[model samples]
Target: MLDIKFIRENVDLVKRVVKNKQLDISIVDSVLKIDEKKRKLIGEVEELRGLKNKYASEKNIEKGKETKLKLQELEPRLSEVEKEFLAAIYKIPNIVSSDTPIGKDESENKVIRSWGTPKEFKFTPKDHLELGTKLGIIDTELAGRVVGTRFTYLFGDAVLLQNSLYQFALEVLLKKGFIPVLPPLFINPDVYTKMARLSPETEIERYAIERDNQYLIGSAEHTLGPMHMGETLNEKALPLRYFAFTPAFRREAGSYGKDTKGILRQHQFDKLEMESFSTPEQGLVEQDFFVSIQEELMQALEIPYQVVAICTGDMGGPDFRQMDIESWMPGQGKYRETHTSDYMTDYQSRRLNTRVKTKNGVEFVHMNDATAFAMGRTIIAILENYQNEDGSINVPSVLQKWMGKSKIQTK
Candidate 1:
């Protein structure tokens, strides 16, 4: 949610942003009109309230009965009007950064830079699904028998590979002086709403216990960002860095055709999430640190990749600005989003009430999050980049110790 004052002062600018992003623009107009109605209603109601107070002190109490009765008739209507105004104000989005490029979708996204080339394959390379099935390491069919589509069971080497990725990612983040935390897989709807991650459209991708009013977390970020919700951290504790590991659930609604063949678009997957809380001056610096860690993690895995700044349309409503690190997938012959390092500034903090008390008595902390490693995508990068002519997969050196094996070959 944006500050109501900001929206009041900049309705036209807000209209331009959501319009360029292809969102419904009428929402902006609705907000402005409702706010106007609310202001007038408040003044009227306050006058009535003041009159009621005045009657309480009247020289002749019975003489004030007519005015009191009129106020009683207006009170309920005033209450309803105030409720409508607040609802409309909450619909407005945050102010977008001017540097964000205007575009309709990801295709219009600009590639800021690029890295290592896709390796030459002596033999046509197989995708992760083909390799997994051939090695009897991934069992999607049995997974279907047990839990239905969009779920899978990993065995032997595939299990090792996935576990290796998690262990390696956790170690890397820990070495960076980040505190590791494992949060509850199930979270209340209220907390989800506070995190600004709850959406009706995402229900299909999410596993929700509607009766319990709880949602399975879709990303460790959902927990990491709100960990300090409604709390005030000391300014001296400027940047509280945290690394989180958790299994994410999503219903993958409306994404029927893309990434359907493998774990790339699963209903459940694992990830290592990095988040931080900092002062306004410190948000970008924390973002830079997160980017450095992301680059290092990719380098450790020996994956070729590039970093690109997200356009205004691509930055979600809660993010002020974002940058993504796309790891090179040789088989796909393109870079895909592997990690996104973002600076949300006070976008999320305003809602979560996670603030810092500066020595100067200032408040409202800045919050930021980045994907340290989204397991399924990392595995895709691994298989595509390190496949052998004989159908073996080479474990990246950094993960070899954790994997306890150098290469994953069919038995």
Candidate 2:
């Protein structure tokens, strides 16, 4: 959410951003109108409060009663106006950075650079889904019977491979001074709403356990973000970095028939995610650092990949800037997105009330969240890229130690 004052002062600029982000500009206008009414009501209420104070001080019962009555009526009106103002403003998106590219969708995203070369296979390479099935490692049919579609049951070596991916990512993040956390997988709707833009418009994208009145986390960031909710931190704790490995759930709502064959788009998957709270000036640097870390991890795994800058319409609502890491899938014969990093400069903190108190003053802390490894996608990348002609999957050199074997072959 943007500051209403900033929106009011820069209406034209805000309107331009709204259009660029493909949001409704009328939301800005609505907020301004509500803000104006709210301010007017506040002034009237303050005057009435002053008069009531004066009447009481002078022992004038009649005027004091009348003033109190006026305040009672005006205060409720002020509350309603304030609610309207907040509702309108919350719909507005964060101001995009000037350097952010302008594009309509992911198709228009700019590729910054690529690393490694896609492997050339003398024999046809099998997709991960086929390889997993042949090796008895992944079963979607069983998952469908057990749960529903868009789910997978990782068997034998596949489970070990995912664990290896998690440990490998943990080693990299730990070296960078990130604290490891196992956040709650279930978050109350209120906290989730404040940490994320979970309006009725996009609520279908989330999974809610109606019986428990809680929502399962779509990503570890959703849980990590609210750790400091409504709390103030010391300046020395700036740039607090955290990483979590958790099972993330999503409804995959409205995404039918897309990547439906494999673990690429699943109802439940494990992910190692990184979240950071930094001083305003350090937010972008922290995000860049995360991107570098992601690149390093991918390079270590020896996967061919590219980094792409997300455009306005494709970026998330709270993102000031976003970047995605796409890994080469040999079976697909293309690069598919495996990771994304978002720099939400104080956009989430403002609503979470996660702040830092310095000698200068207090202000909302900037936040960045990025994927270290979406384990299922990482598994796909590894399986497809490292497959041998005989249908065995070679483990990345870095993960071989934990995986206990160089290659996984059918039993």
Q: Where does the lowest 10-residue lDDT sum fall in candidate 2?
A: 193-202
Candidate 1's C-alpha runs over 4 A off are 51-79, 200-205
**Whole-model lDDT per candidate:** 0.80, 0.91
Per-residue CA lDDT of model 1 for 1-411, tens digit only, reads 677777778878888877766678898888778778877877877887787778778754774686678777777877887677655655555666666667777776677776666677888877777777777877889999999888988889877887888888777777777898988888887777667677553456667898988989988888888888889999887789898888988888768878777777888888888889999889878888998888888888878898887876667766777889998776667778989887888877887888788866857898889998888888878987898877789999998998898999987
In candidate 2, the residue pairs with backbone N, CA or C atoms under 3 Å apart (3 or more residues apart, or in different chains) clash, namely none
What's model 1's lDDT at 201?
A: 38
The TM-scores of all predictions, comma-separated, are: 0.91, 0.98
